[model samples]
Target: MIFIPLWQRLLVALATVAAILLALPNMFYGRVEVANDARASIAQGLTSPELEADAGLWPSWLPSGLINLGLDLRGGAHLLAEVQVSDVYASRMDSLWPVIRDALAADRDTVGFVTREDGPPSELHVRISKPEGAARALEIVRGLARPVASLSGGGSSDIEVRAQNDLLIVNLSEAERAATDDRTVQQALEIVRRRIDEVGTREPTILRQGADRILVQVPGVGSAQEVKDIIGTTAQLTFQPVVQRTSNKDADPGAGNILVPSVDEPGVYYILDRAAVVTGEDLTDAQPTFDQNGRPAVSFRFDPQGARAFGEYTGAHIGEPFAIVLDNEVISAPVIQSAIPGGSGIITGQFTPEESTDLAVLLRAGALPAELTFLEERTIGPELGADSIQAGKNAAYAAAVMVVLFMIASYGVFGAIACVALAINIVMIFASLSLLGATLTLPGIAGIVLTMGQAVDANVLIYERMREELRRGASPVKAVQEGFDKAFSAILDANVTTFIIAAIMFFVGTGTVRGFAVTLAMGVVTTMITGVYVSRVLIALWFARTRPKTIVV
Candidate 1:
């Protein structure tokens, strides 16, 4: 007689129950989501009557993990942004000015008097007093060139220096530019991801596209504009010594100075030094706080090097006005009253509470390396997502109903048993998705429906084998054992091949394809557990109770 051990039956029963419990949260998705958000807020030291009520909606002891819905399923904003990589070239040239100036100054006898000459933003031009000293200036600049910090740029220098008559022209090398482009895109991707995560959105898709573009998909956000507003801020903060205040937007601040408009004051501008005393890159921490007058502001602390430099600069230039610039606009120009040795300072402006909070978030997330120009943007509405969900449910229900009827009509009792295993298989798939925190897209639903149909294949193989065994004059007990044993190899082979393809699809593909692959791969595993083992346990229990001598084929 066929026998499934008591331990095996109990294990299957326990696992099936556990899967059902884990997938239970999805049934009340909205309530559970609210409860989760409330719990998260409470954990962060927040309290409110409404939050407390929401937190009590779900029991803490039960599993609260739910499958994350993908952007296509939940509705969200999608953006394709192209990084302005050329902007970095200008910044690089600007930074190189001080280094080149200092280097040429060290050899004043040979290089003579050096003065920065205005030219293109992407190139630095320094005219020397002595025309014959061009060769020496180029030599000094070339000596300062460092090796590119990338494997592909081995033995290549970061800067290419050449002498154009009396002027020393400097530009970034091609290899260095390529490496910088890659790093800029990667840094932008990470900063964008951090900004989105700060808003507590789930399963956002942030990925690099091509050479200089990024694709961002944030699910459950209000609109594309909202998503853009969150990540679009450059947050380029700098503190520069103020040259003077002016009202003329067309006023040239002469060499080594820039004109920036005021953030709070209309028509007013400040001519500030081109070189900054400290930048946002030196900030270690930032948070929303209030100024001395109880006005909304952002407080920031700097790193050790920045702290030392700021303290020395403030001590040397007491009572002098310094412009706090952000994204080419002056936020405020405050005079230094005392040396700020503590490395902490407040940024005051005509800011609302929400604006202060958002500025804090942006400062904490760090500045984007370069600007992002939105090439494409799309916003999906919740109503559309609801319709998609309903359609997907209808498709799944239809597939399940058709499969159930066909299985019941085909092999009588055995087919009915297979339908039960199929039900368990579906539960296991959802449970796996929940546990993995995977996003389920519309394609994922198609995968589940496909799994339901394929789930009965193993049962069909075993039942057909049993029919052959019965026709060969074997008793029901022997036929049952042989049927399972003979069908195991074929089932294993089929699932193994399908699993390989699914793995390939998962690793190589992105977005929707990956969602489909995840469900398909999970189905393969659950099918094996239910179709072969669970069916055997149920059949064995029936045999032990009924003790049938013969069975219909």
Candidate 2:
């Protein structure tokens, strides 16, 4: 008589039950999603009556994970941005000025008075009073160069120093520039990812497309402009000593000073020191809060180094005014009444509560290394996603119905068993997706439809084998045993080859192609379990209940 081991049968039953449980949440997707969001909010210390009610929609004991929908199946914003990597070169040169000045100052008798001359942003030109000291100036400047900090920039220094006439010219080395460009792009990618994650958007596809481009797809955002608003602001916060406040927009602020317009005052400007006492990079934490006058503001704390620098600057300039500048505009210029320690401060501005919250998020995410210029942007509508989802459902349903009918008509009892296995295979596929938190796209749906047809191939092979055995006058029990035993090898081989192809696609493809590969790969695993093992167990149980002398293959 055909039989299956007790332990094997129990294992299959347990897996089936577990898969069904895992997949149950998807059937109530809307309710489960609301419960998930509410739970997240509650965990973050936010609570209200509506939140409590929503959180109660799903029991805490049940699995809450769901397959995330990809951008093609969920409305969102798409942006293709190119990072201005050259901007960092200018910044690097600007920051190097003080070091170059101080280094050359030690030998002032030879180099004479050093003054910076206007030139390209990427190059720093320092003019000395004595043209004969050019070689000495170049030596001092080159001494400040450090080895490039990248593998590809092996023995190259970060800066190239050379003298032309009475001036010492400094520029970033080519290798160093290449490394900086890569680092700038990578930093921009991570900052964008963190900002999106802070806002709790789900499964955003933020990827570096090329050398200096980033591709961002955010599901559930209203528009591309909204995304740009969140990420495009440089958020370059700086604290600089104010030279003088003036009403003229075009006033020249002399050497080593910049004229910045006030954010809140019309046509008013503040001439501030070029070098900042501290910048946003030193910030360790930031949060949204109200000012003493109950206006929305952001509070920030700094790291140890930043704290020391800030404390020293404030202590030395107790009676001086310092401007809190953000993105090249002065947000406020308050006079220092006393020395402030601890490196903690509040940024007061004309901000609403939402604006303050967004600012806090940006500060906490850290500033982008380079500015981004958006080259292309598009917003997908929810109605389009809804229609695509419906179309996918219709296609899946049609595929399932046709597969079910064909299997039943072909093998009769065996075909019915195959149909049951096919249903279980689908549930297991979805369970795997939910557990792995994979994103499902429109192409992913097509993968599932394709899997339904392939799932029954194992059943067909076994039934045909049984027919061959029966024609040779084999006993009914002998035929059933030999059918499963002989057909497993072919089943394994077919699924294994398909699995290899899926793996290749997953690794080599991008975006929606990977989505298709994910579903197809998951289907291969489920097909082996449900189609081969489960079908055999069901057949064994069927034979045990009613042992027939003769069987129709």
Candidate 3:
């Protein structure tokens, strides 16, 4: 039978148990309580949007205020989004172009110029009287191009492209030297949060670091698909024609006699509008407040045109009600009690503080250009998450029992050595996760189970090799050495492929896929170490002293 030194074996067994204990507690997350002040510190920089985006970020359900569950353990939704930076860059460039245009046109004497007049967002055409002088004018526009160095990739390569002649071409990066900072991933995170604000989330946590990838955490949200819809779609708000408002025909302040078209179903409402007078583009802020009659309501303010139209409409209508609608649904209708002079006013109606707060959040985040449909939805309650975790644990325990029994029964003593090392590999995986602050998802657990199987894969190869060497009449030491040597390449290639797949999962996949990918990656790495290397060391030391010839065979 395979014989092992007691001291070495005991040391490994203890280490394995300790690693499991450290990682076991984190499998489920619930609540933690702390002093109010500590909780307050944790609450720092946590805004409504932040809290709504990440329910975990706030000490909402946790009275202890200590630890919270991640999506993996707690069973929350995960989202993946491919961000587009072109729109944001084009917008910023468009805004700055006006300032540049004014500055250049002001110094007309410096260089004679003819405006291309009509040009795309980034493309400008100009005919200069003195072609040589156009370069100086170009310098002014070029001076304004600081190259948006942001955390998101959108603005990183964000340089102002100067086309030949008097034309200013604003292509991102044509040269080999591209600026870096705000990677597309960071931009996506921020943009997604903003969009979530527009739609209002239960609570989400979005963090950004990578160039093209972002991490989004949503607690208590069951629908990954719904979250994706809200965050993924770019709600390009526009002012369309109001064929009907919620109420009857009314005159808008600026346009005179404004009519917004709308149809109300049992619970669902739709406002069919042609063109909009003013959309969310001019909206600045919206808040909930008590009107003059102490009625719960919301107050909104618009930018220049929005303000002017609002003011003129309210002033002229005097008694008619103006509708505050969102996504074609009428939120509130408040009558013109008095003239709203400054482009800011309040909407008084039947609304809870929560509803008002939600409305305010939506407006502040901006609105969708048109209506949206829920293509898909799925919900996972906390109970379901608990059940899933329990089921996973049970399965793991069963699998471990079966694998351990099989390994020892088949190979006798050498098989038992592999089992012990395999156990250590599992423990090491958990320990590493705890240390790394990685969440153990259900998929992650599956990854671990799969890893447990693969953990033995390397050992099996080496053990088989050693057995073959012994049959061929090689010395025990030479068999062991040659077995490890021969199996190295195969293990390397197989594990490397798995590692690459995990990397891809981290990049393209979101939420659960990512969790599985992470655990798989970590397990693969540790399996190589503990399963292949660590197990060999322990076996090597034992064989050196005992010098067993026909080991447990």
Candidate 4:
């Protein structure tokens, strides 16, 4: 330990210097964050002269990473939402009506007239005029069963269509329901992530909870209500062919048609075909742009198949009006002036620039599979977070001071060396956190304070071993070497056991506990480096230059 080679010593020194440099950004986090944001904006062509100046505040080559503060530290919104996954079941059965009707109508001889039977919302019940035809109807419907393509229920049929008495019931099978529930939750999670990211929030925590719930924690957001508004809109966009345009609010729109109120004109309603010509799922991209009238509008491009279908529909119905519906409200009804062969079109409405931008974002993100009910919500104030941060800083300083004073009083010059190593260890911890983009919470700060004591444990063992060696009349260099060698087993064993525990906590814990685990895990690795290798290098250099024959312990 006392005789570290020049190459190894230089490598350790360079690494320590690099870690300190990487951690420097955290000291000026506000400026660095502004600079980083400006740089990103410039990349997106949203740059102005003011933003470019901000970008110059921090050089691009420097380490721009900063430790992300968790919701607890930064003060933001927390929301727990329960997804209504079963709601999709009713719609699924309703959509199967066309397929079932078409299939049975093809074999009309024995099936006779097929009418939908009023039954459970979870099931599709259709009665055949001829009871004897139930078996044949079941066979036709069962032929429509699709293989479940899911991780949970792979290679199984997605639906079960069976004959019960005079009625044929169609519903999702057990395996299929499990698969559907999983998919609904996954899609909801992705949609929520996209919506939040679209709003430009940093480091939002969105994760699945239980079977049909989501936990969202967005730091730096103003309120839980703001986040809820962004994600809760549903924003289901669809294009339907207009059957009739009317001024009557209470007019019967006929079966298979829906009466939707116009968004700009409150009293006017449009009766649109129940089946959609295209949906937002077909959209490939959407951007806020000016229309031909120089008004704010949203232009959307479609995927290949959607583009083909849309182009054909418009080409065939040149002079007919189509309603652009959003969440059951008609945003606009415009006649197809000509065939849009390029698969892109613009949506014009009485929209401001902000509204157009938000709608574009919603279109690009896609729709949620199911509606979410906010079960719990809370907004944390910045004042409380500031207080917590101040308290954490005080605790850390007190711990560092006490540890440093104790080390100085006990081990003299060796204690001073240990203190330097401890300081380097703290820098390394922050560097690691920043590099990993880990969120720092209050509990994580507590972990740092705890690590302050642990950082010097190896030094304590080494110094005591050195005293023992000196008592045996060993030379200073030999005593240092034996001290490090003897304490190696104890240091390695203690750190490894604690590291295992930290790993367990990191894997099993959630939220604050996981944050604590992250800091503790990082601290353990940094402690091993600074307390063992760094301290050894510093002492080795001192001994090599001094060539001391004997030393007081």
lDDT of each: 0.91, 0.91, 0.62, 0.89
Q: Please state the error at residue 511 of candidate 3 in Å.
A: 7.8
Error of 2 at 550 (Å): 2.8
Per-residue lDDT of candidate 1, residues 283-328 (tens digit):
9999999999999999999999999989999999999998899889
Please give each candidate's TM-score: 0.97, 0.96, 0.52, 0.93
Model 3, 4-123: lDDT tens per residue?
A: 467766766676666766555444333221233334444675445433444443344432212234564565675444344344444444344446557677777775644533455444
Scored by lDDT, the top model is 1
Greater lDDT among 1 and 2 belongs to: 1
Poorest lDDT segment (10 consecutive residues) of candidate 2: 544-553
TM-score (C-alpha) between model 4 and the true structure: 0.93
Clashing pairs in 1: none
lDDT of 4: 0.89
Deviation from native of the Cα of residue 553 in model 2, angstroms: 3.0
The TM-score-based order of candidates, best leading, equals: 1, 2, 4, 3
Candidate 4 residue lDDT tens string, 415-490 = 9999999999999999999999999999999999989999899899999999999999888888898999999889
How would you encode candidate 2's per-residue C-alpha lDDT over 7-122 as one tens digit per residue?
A: 99999999999999999999999999999999999999999999999999999999999989887788899999999999999888778988888888889999999888878889
- Give candidate 3 regions above 4 Å deviation: 1-22, 31-257, 260-279, 282-351, 380-387, 431-444, 469-478, 501-518, 540-553
| Model 3 residue-pair collision total | 40
- Which candidate would rank higher by lDDT, 1 or 3? 1
